[model samples]
Target: MTTNEETIVMTPLWLAIEENLLALEGQNITEENKEKTVQKLVGELDGKGYAVSKSGIKMMALRWALEDMLKVGRPMLKDLTKALSELTLEDLANPCHASYRVTDNLGKTWERVQKTDRRDALIQMFEEAKLDLLVQKAKGLDGDLGIRLLIEETVESPVILERMGIPQEKLDQVHADIAAEIAARNKVLSLLETVEGKPDHEKVKFLFSNDIPEDLIIEVAQIAQADIDKAKKAMEEELKEQQRLAEEAAAKKKAEAEGPALEDIPMDQMAEHIYAIREIQYFSDVEKEIRTMCEQSAIPKAIVDLSFSDPDKFDELEKQCEG
Candidate 1:
């Protein structure tokens, strides 16, 4: 073959490793034989095209090197290394903090290298070495290996849920609900702070109070009355119009069906009707609990005095008592 043709056909030492290994597999090779063979393979790959210096070979070797470091790394970092070794694509894309990202990437690269042939075998060499010693040495430098060890030692350890008495599903839902409620209430509470005074904070604290606050009756009434007045005004107008039409239609239908005019229909009393219905069923369990809590709790006698006599004076208290 011509020099150019020979050069093209000749596989580099790294490239020829597979062919050589396949040839060696048929022979009876022991531990000593395997070592000599690896040395020979390295020399041949180095001789042909100086494969060790090539980018592909260097990349492959670097990967193998990282894996070796992991297997022999210190005990403290062993868990971190194992965790890193198991990372998937989803793990890589997650928006983790920056330092964690670096450690994850190093683990991913090592895993990928371990899957390749020459690189895989090279890694085994290090895994068989004194891994704990290598890891100890690694912690001395701020390399990928060192960061991994540090992370392993410092990361918050996972608590076993079973031991903590938390069901996994319950824990997950609690996390999600807390996140959602916090987001939703943050803005409302912020506005309450700016527009209203710290009354909201006090109200929150007193919400479950056994003994209602001395001022609770007056405060609840003032707030509820304002809200009720606005709602009543709007709802009354709408309900009146609806009632007027219903009365006229009922009269017309009844007169036609009976062959005589129905007596003047009573004016719709929907607003009062709705208020009565609402007032009948208002007190919540929370309110009842608070009322019953009077034994050990200091309930403002003023609120208790007003609530028992005419709860309607405070709309929510009325609802809680009635509901």
Candidate 2:
């Protein structure tokens, strides 16, 4: 591209002129204000770094505006035209217009046009408004901001759909769809509220999984209240019994690990134990163990050694073993 084509110069004077000239577009000028208008244009261009004639300023502004229109407004115009053309005369005549009515000099009025009209009068106004808004944004703005202005106007068909119009049949379908959604939401809400007060029982879970209605679940919950209570009490009792068994077992194990104490037994029985320890291989050192037993029982060594060496000599040993 040429340097002039590649670069954009946005000095205050050219911008002011461009803005003023754009504001004058689509006006029906009369001879009375013609000279005044030209003078105003000349005055706006007078105080700039460079001097330019009134005609020159007007030409450049118009060119810039036109270029912007082609680059941005044309695509938007095409899309909106498509949006408008989609509407039938039936859509335009829908009493719904009372809601979207555009008001003006005559008060609130809805325009009704024939299906075969050569031009859609309102579309022209819509296009011009959108076009002017985009052109305003194009001034001294570039990249995403300028591009965004255009993109924003090019809204998808899903939005502004009322402007494009929909048939009564499609409206009915939408109504049915909305009803279904609301009903499903209500069911889910009811289920959620119901489940919160209920237990995580398999029966309740099964009922929910099968999509049983809330009223039925409420009735079942009433019948199962006693059963649920019974089940919970039974579970707690079972856990307590298990804990009792564990404690009893632990006590038994501790008692078994610790043999009978010397003070807790009589001398004769202690003598018999020492005799039994002699016969059993449980004592790592039999002689030392017998001595410890003799001292703990306060029995004489001679007596213990005799009893441990000859179990038959202890008369009580036979009866105790039998017992």
Candidate 3:
């Protein structure tokens, strides 16, 4: 064959030997054993119908190594070596070209070429490493709370959800469910704050006053109750001191102040004296005003009810109505 044809035919053999040499480096094969290893590799390549000589292999290895050392920086070489060190036999089975586009810290773009098999193996290893990191982060979280957080993160990022390979319909459902959960939790928290100093029965009544799901309300209430118990226990001594002062102040006021005999009045006539009754009256008046406004604006009662139940839904309905 001509010299040009000979060079073309010999290139692949040289590259194969170089790859094997790199693999040996990765394995940490001792220098004393490397010659035998390369000789054996030469035999295998020769058996495969390649024209390989020991001296030719040595020349190619030295040339390729020098070229790589000259072209690549230390950090990049270290990373490449580390990646090669972790390769498996299976990873080397399917050979293809894999192109990489990366940007360095100095904003310089670098295009690195890799074998497809190696790239796939690295991707798999990276995914597993990320999973391990996530598990470590989730170690102390309560059961499924960590998973819920992950789902939330996935739902928030459309790209992540798409990459997860979940069906579009399922993703939509998850998004809806997470949104409802967040809204319900926020509503529960708002109600809890509203009834912060109220009795448990009053708190339950106020929570039920909103159009929240019974199961969600119960769950949030239980969690809030636990937090309330912890806080109350911590403030127990302070509360006792405040109670004693309140009682002393009340006794002083009772001795010095005079008031009408409202206690002698009939229960029905004493409605204004009851705070619960006053609250009911106030809400009833507000409801009547809302109804009047709805009727005057020709708005449906359903829309008004939605406004009370879910302001978000009501706003959407209002926009549709306007449209």
lDDT scores in order = 0.43, 0.48, 0.50
- Span of 10 residues, lowest total lDDT, candidate 1: 258-267
User: C-alpha displacement of 21 in model 3, angstroms?
Assistant: 6.6
What does candidate 3's lDDT look like per residue over 41-92, in tens digits? 6676666556566466555644444344334433233454355445343333
**lDDT for residue 150 in candidate 3, whole number 0-100:** 51
Q: Output the number of the TM-score-best candidate.
A: 3
TM-scores, all candidates, are: 0.21, 0.20, 0.30
Query: Could you give the candidate ranking by lDDT, starting with the highest?
Result: 3, 2, 1
Off by over 4 Å in 2: 1-73, 76-245, 256-259, 279-323
Task: Summarize candidate 2's per-residue lDDT along 1-323 as a digit string, tens digits.
Answer: 13656855444443354455555655544557655665665665555423445456555643443344334423223333444444443344432341133322112111212112313444444454454444454443653344333334563324323432444454445446656656765665566565565554544554556575545545644436555455556657878999999999998876544545534657676657656555543544566776675555555444455455776865455456546
The alpha-carbon deviation from the true structure for residue 5 of candidate 3, after best TM-score superposition, in angstroms, is 34
lDDT of 1 by residue, 213-319 (tens): 32442344234545434544665787899999999999886545433111222213322322433443354335455454431233333443344556666455434
How many clashes would you count in candidate 3? Answer: 0
* Weakest lDDT window of 10 consecutive positions for candidate 2: 105-114
